[model samples]
Target chain A: MTPSTDSPPRIYTAALAIIGNEILSGRTQDANLNHLAKTLNGWGVEMREARVVPDIESEIVAAINALRARYDYVFTTGGIGPTHDDITADSIAKAFGLPLVEHPAAIALLEHYYPPGELTVVRRRMARVPEGADLIENPISKAPGFKIENVFVLAGVPSIMRAQLQGARAFIAGGRSVLSRTVSVLVGESKIAELLETAQGQFPDVDMGSYPFFKRNALGTALVLRGREEARLEAAYDVLVGALSAAGIEGHPGELPD
Target chain B: MTPSTDSPPRIYTAALAIIGNEILSGRTQDANLNHLAKTLNGWGVEMREARVVPDIESEIVAAINALRARYDYVFTTGGIGPTHDDITADSIAKAFGLPLVEHPAAIALLEHYYPPGELTVVRRRMARVPEGADLIENPISKAPGFKIENVFVLAGVPSIMRAQLQGARAFIAGGRSVLSRTVSVLVGESKIAELLETAQGQFPDVDMGSYPFFKRNALGTALVLRGREEARLEAAYDVLVGALSAAGIEGHPGELPD
Candidate 1:
């Protein structure tokens, strides 16, 4: 075999579509976006963006279509239940220009879980998926979520969404995992803004951010460094810490408690 | 003056753009979206959509432009601090094709807040805003947020953002407030899905949603009815409760505890 030259690592990106009126209406605080972001980051997939849209069909279709075309993966949560407002399946089908059909496997799963003849018409609505879609197992509830192309439709409930995401892991082809390190100091962010800007200029490849926090009646800042390369991140962190030391501020290794 | 006809009330809509890499990176769970949504709802401005974008200027500009054009008002939280990562003001300027300029009022506020000679060049960045923008006062910190056209820019910190939003309230023109009523029943959503659908069909003006919950080792569903008219929402709620009673299910007045 011939030796191949090294090339840059590919990046995998994902976007989330939170489909629910409860979230947009402030009736429910979405707990899924953060979980999905951290989980995808651990799997080496960067969560680039997220949209919280109401339960309306046109809105869901627009968000799904836009996100799916722009990223490697698109995950949708909410509006997959058996209620009348559960229109995500129909919206996804419309977005893909596909037909909505009842998946036999999903029907079978519901059949096995519920008592005989207990799956009413409304309950059977959970078995519907877009044509040419595959099922993403939901261990929490017998009714399964479906995957159509790059979009994975999961239950709105956090626990079921997390479990179905595990079922989705095998399908995702992750790239290089982005590593992050945080340095904290008991000083306002303005005090270290100049130093961070200089360090950021020095390490152009590393992404740096300064987040301020107020704890115990004192203000502090947490400086985070993120990159695909560990050594580069460490070098930037060392430079930042050295600069803080020169400025007579003690930089800690991790963030302070909120 | 001539008497006016009893026409339908207008609906005021708004969108939010969350500008921060920390939010997309899952390092911080966003505490502003819920508060903003709830506050806007109480002000009779419906929060129709929200987008969470990273600190990239192009992304921020794109989200702001899209949201500002589509909604009556647009609000953004984050990236407006004294740090180098604070690029929201510049991004908003670019979004509007307006020149970024240091506002004299903002500079005065910062100058008065900080001690003499304590407002460094980096801290002075907080005074920079797009040309032809009004300042939104931040009571917690003197660094003011800005309102450019239909867009209101606020701080990323929850406390500061909340205070700034209050300052922006005077500029808002609110429509009729949306009123909501919830009824809870100890049954899976599927059990009442058909009845809820029937109720929704009867009262087309009222928006209905069913949210499933699991508490104390039992399953329940909360059916929420929302509309601009109080009497219409109450009528829908009563019909839904009557349906549940007819089915021999005792429906509670409000949602179950999570």
Candidate 2:
């Protein structure tokens, strides 16, 4: 993949591919993407793309190939379970031309979780990992995750997936923390246009945004200010609060002031 | 754009671009893509791709150009609010070489929502919809959304965006509705291999999947069956339920068997 040429501190982008028919069917309100998005964004990595595909081998391979070449990292959720339809491991192996073998690290983790005497037939598949890949520790369940190239295959279940992500977070490179602050007001967003514009200019290095939430009950629109700069974030935040005060709209500094 | 050399199925495909800094900053968890995903799935149209881009003109345009050319439709959320940061209308117009103009239908809706002099600043900006685009009525805010080519641009907030989506649902064409059924069992997903294998063979056209979720701290798995054919869906669902029962795990109709 060609590297990004221009730079103003480029965002480290990743694409999330959620492979499950359940999420699309509305049976499982998938929270993995949202969780990953917030986590990656906080680390200053940009979640550029997200897609959900059914549990099809061809589909999975296609999506992995298509997305991995573009983004810095490609994370997949679902279909790593011990069930018959859990074909993500095989698909990843095929995509990377790697042999489907039990990695020593994964077998150890799986064995630690479910010993030979206590092992169920279904639990045996959890030990298999693609050859030449490192095991991604599953803090919640010992069914370890694995990586191939830029793709990190994970479980579909939110709880386990989040745990796997936490273990894998430190491995992600090119991340810088972006501190955020918010200033919400009852004043309509358009009423504070000049204030927001001034704030943006004042903090050119910081990426500033104004988000207006709906009026609570019969109050008014709440315009929340956000940016990366701490002092400027607070300063712009103060200016926004003062603008709301001038407009007779009461507000306070909060992450999400209602 | 060249049509897929392969056969075009009854299913419709779309890509979603969520243009918002609110979502990126973790200030607002985006519900638009998920809502649209479920809605589109119900309608039989597949949501192929989704991206959460900041309200930047070049980024928005590039995403729209890439996705619109690849998928059947592109739906963008956010950047249509009353705030100066709401750049969706202007961006969409610029993307398609369409001129930005005050849309009459939108102006009428905005005028009805606010008293004449109350929100002139807000309503005035909302009135500026691109020329040659149709209005997507907003029952919540009276700020009508716009549709250009295959791109449908809507609001960021869940409630208002949902309202606009209801108005625009009919406009989607050539997409297939996704039919899914589930059989939940008290047993974990690992034990359901034979049943899952049988379910897959019986329902070749339909995509069958198993999702295990913890309800009240109990380990239970849902054998979700999804397909386009009603008869296939019913047949597969029945097979799944029977397989579960035979495996000593109970399965019943109408959601998962408790």
Who wins the DockQ comparison? 1
Q: DockQ of all candidates, in order?
A: 0.86, 0.39
Q: Could you tally the backbone clashes for each prediction?
A: 0, 6
Best by TM-score: 1
Q: Tens digit of lDDT per residue, candidate 1, span A25-54?
A: 999999999999999999999999999999
Total clashing pairs in model 1: 0
What lDDT tens digits, residue by residue, belong to model 2 across residues A54-86? 677888888888889989999999988888888
What's the TM-score of each model vs. the native?
0.97, 0.86
Across B1-258, the per-residue lDDT of candidate 2 in tens digits comes to 223354746667887888886665555667777788888787767876666677789879887888899888788888886666788888888888889998877777767667677656655787776788988876665657788889998878788789988878778775557777766777777778666877798677777677777886788877777766677688777777777777777774555533
- Candidate 2 CA-lDDT value: 0.74
* Candidates in order: C-alpha RMSD to true structure: 2.4, 5.3
Error of 1 at B5 (Å): 9.0
